[model samples]
Target: MIRVFGMHNIQPLLNKVYPKATTANGVYIYDEYGKAYLDGSSGAVTCSLGHSHPRLIPYIKQQLDKLQFVYRSQFGSEEAEQLATRLFEHSPERIYAHSFFVNSGTEAIETAMKTAVQYWQEKGFPSKQQFITRWKSYHGITVGALSLSGHPLRRQRFESTLEKYPRLKADLENDTLEKLTEEFVQVIESIGANHIAAFVAEPIVGAAGTALTPQAGYYQEMKKVCEHYQILFITDEVMTGLGRTGTWFGIEHWNTTADIVAIGKSLGAGYAPIAATLMTDEILEPIKNGSGLIMSGHTYSGHPLSCATANRVLEIIEEEQLLDNVNTQGEYIKQQLNVLKENYPVIQHVRGKGLMLGVEFDPARKGFQQKLIERCFQNGLLVYPSVGGPEGKDENGILVSPPFIISRSEADELLAKLDQSLNEINQ
Candidate 1:
């Protein structure tokens, strides 16, 4: 028998007695004692459909009945093919025509890195193996994925083992597009573009940057630079993909596209463990023709049950027109957040798109974010912590992302709980 409580095998916070979730539905998670905590952050900015969606449960059961698992090499399932097609259809310009499935966002990012290198290698340019990324961004947690990320706290302990990928230190919030673009050019010149594999970035910096958005023409200029330097442009859309950003793909908001995209989080939408590396025909054709394979995959790369569940998740989003709801509730909540910012002097920033909003408090206030988070938790609200401050190293940010399926009344209740939490923090 397994121990039910203290000193357990699964400890997210080793020092604290974390609440054990007993049940959940819609935007609320019930603790073991029957207290309901509103899922304001959508469970780490995933879980777009919220907990135990009625439609999703039945569909998943149906898939489990038909097929549970299948190794990618031995057999191909209709689920995988349709999921790939759905991702491609949702991507910008339909350029990302190929999808390589994986189990999580970390795996997706790692696979994307390998795919970028393999694309260049297949095209007879093996030296293009280095990558360029921003200082205020996070790709994933794996070693290879972390190598390309510039998040400081996450890389501190494992600093000696990670790769020295060129990380551009320009500020996304205050820097001009020209300056930001020039920094990339200078880095490419300094490192030599021929030696760089790709340039990876989050469309709207999350977790590491507190929903930091760049100038309007930021990606357009960066994409132009990549085109000129013969480097692939990869977008880490793990958080902003699917219907989270109102648009299917976050980059679509900029009227641009990427050569490669690594998407997770909302793709599975709390229904299944699924993610994928998506690329264009140009990127895939050479590798398909030369190596006859992508040269990277896992045992559960295309697990049939996971794929089917994810496929149904995407379809429900489509059928329900949740994208429109994202814009509607997102605007309302963001407006209310701004109102909160006005009343609370601690809130330094309120920024994000659609349902994926973030609020940054004054990092100078000692233990401010922690206090606010605790107060919110006590008030039956759950939000996600993020990094903020001038250096992007402080834990002063909180993501206010709620489920897309949230209705107007639920939205009000969420905001009321948040307001109460902030009031308590003020006390």
Candidate 2:
């Protein structure tokens, strides 16, 4: 039997035997052999409610029965409107005035990129189309999104087609507010802010390992600089938004506002493929006054079924008070991870907020992270291997972002399995 593979790593599938997932519930996925694997990273951090969330299923089914899809340009659905209202309700007031829905995080990011450029064009600055992003960041897989991502390995294959946006190093440490501001000013001075459309970054660098966070007042200073030069500050929150990082939005941790934000992953909670790009009135007004139309959209953009599913996901997050669980259990998990770190010298750093955590190993232990993940899978635990940066070819790590509803006992079980895996790998 010939089997078709998926994604960029097609070669690996040829020789590797993968588990056939028969069922999943809560924080566990079961194979055809009935071997259960604990979902440590929540399926690339998309299953925010874990598997088969009870509340989400019914709403999705109802929406499916009522209306599965709708063309956004021809018609608008109440489901889509409610989703927008819910998003606005959770976001800071008067900041995000519009929401453009798309089917995936990459689409949302691509939308934000186009929105930023077109916003300037609508404001009579056609030359302001250049973007500035950081090194070691992962935006998405599409051409525009790939152009914005600074991950060397991911962009390597597409170097010929990707735009060479001016990049900055994301120095979480050694970056004071002054230095952060200076970096933005330098970029603006180098490119001329009038020629720059946006400055994009993740709130907490995900995929690059979760806790590559900024220093205190860093984002505030950066935002100030962007505002001074009229460059839109676009926060890519695909993995950090919708309560993934202990808050509704990761940028909220810094107490700063973004001109544009891309949201996904937990937005649909793996129930549907959906994402949205949110923007403030300041960026939207000029376009509304000028062209009064947005040129970017997809066929599945604002799909009613997807919007309804996402709205319910948000409602469930609030109703279940999962954010509180995230805070409480996130701290507990980090504590456990730190304890594991002390016992294993290979484990160098444990960093993250809420449930989104990163455990970076000392790179000197070559191939240690991959081996750990393999060993953990055999031991019935699943984790995501993380590559740190351009120099991350040798660096090893894992992202431990679990669902927000993870309980203290479940967190403990996760830690226990991780401890056992680490011990086994160490031996």
Candidate 3:
């Protein structure tokens, strides 16, 4: 097996072990051998519109015929502007007046953090630099984003290197809503409000586990606390945005908004590498009014080709009314998963919102997760196990997020395969 450093020395699947040549469409992936597997998890909750959508190719071709690349530093392109405008239409106007495009989710997160710090500095609170993130969260693999992530296994080796930023673990399980809010507030207070730039979190914790939705009124309370201390609220919606949770933004479920919103994964609908960090006018005012420049720039910051592709995706999503499909199908999947939980002794929990679903196994059932994955694979299904759990143990769960384009028949097929896989595990 080959191992290579991915996003800060994290061991990613190497070419030797995970050989390339593949074909995929909708919710099915095929290897070079022509063995097809149902993409149960949508390739880590990406491919939301499914792989190789017919419309994306023509859109990309059209952009290529016109202009493939343009420097967004000094110039503005119609594609980029149009995509930004569409994104804002879906999100809260107060949360996303200005956007900075990047290549991936981690890049978006890193940009959000830096933007928060810069906004504070521009507001004459240069001391506000530290950030607070919750435990068991996956923000991405970039160093800056990793510093804000709380996934234990992902950060175990990098802790020594990330000591500059103070880390505070918010209780995700034990603490009551008020207690958790107070704990988070105390952490910021201890670091001094003037020194804490932002508090970042996933409104519906995606990678850690499907829709680990916060306690009642938790986020609303947290927002109030941040407002009181003048701290920026940054919501990492890489997996939960784009109508994944029955809403344009998952934070809407709590009736709250963030100062900055990091969105990706589904934005391009697997057609392009595009991610963005959105901020309110308040957050961008200082920089716009002062230097009129953001300190960050990337070679492909707003690549025209990517923007064009993403814009087409946005159009398709709207024209197809996929958000309605997401809500309807998401509710169906949740109900079915709940039925499974009731039937299986090993199934401990069924959680998530919209299409993002998780099925946690009993911790006492050793090797259950691996057994489940192997069974699913043998049955021509593809699913992703939760990251950062006890090795060789059933300490984690599995994600079951298919594309929004999936139909009723496809959903039935997935459920049948899942039932068979679960039965095999029970035996």
Predicted structure with the largest lDDT when compared to the true one: 1
Q: Pick the candidate with the highest TM-score.
A: 1
Q: After superposition, how far is residue 98 of candidate 1 from its true place, in Å?
A: 0.9
What CA root-mean-square deviation does each model show from the true structure? 1.4, 2.2, 3.6
Candidate order by lDDT, decreasing, is 1, 2, 3
Q: Rank the candidates by TM-score, best first.
A: 1, 2, 3
- Tens-place lDDT per residue, model 3, 180-273, is 8778778877888888899899987776644566766888998999999998999999999887787889899889899999999988877789
Clash counts per candidate, in order, are 1, 0, 0
lDDT of 2 by residue, 1-427 (tens): 6655543355445767677799999999999999999898999888999999987888787777899887888999999999998898899654787899998999999999999989999988999999998876889999899999877778888899999899886466556677667777887898998899999999898786446777778888888888889889999999999999899999999999899999999999888999999998888899899999987999999999999999999999999999999899998999989999999998888888998999989888888888899988998888887776335454488999888878878888889999998998899
Cα RMSD, model 1: 1.4
**lDDT (Cα atoms) of all candidates against the true structure:** 0.91, 0.87, 0.82
Which pairs of residues collide in model 2?
Answer: none
The weakest ten consecutive residues by lDDT in model 3 span 387-396
Candidate 1 Cα misplacement greater than 4 A, ranges: 1-6
List candidate 3 segments past 4 Å from native. 1-16, 19-21, 164-174, 387-395
- Inter-residue clash pairs, candidate 1: 130-197
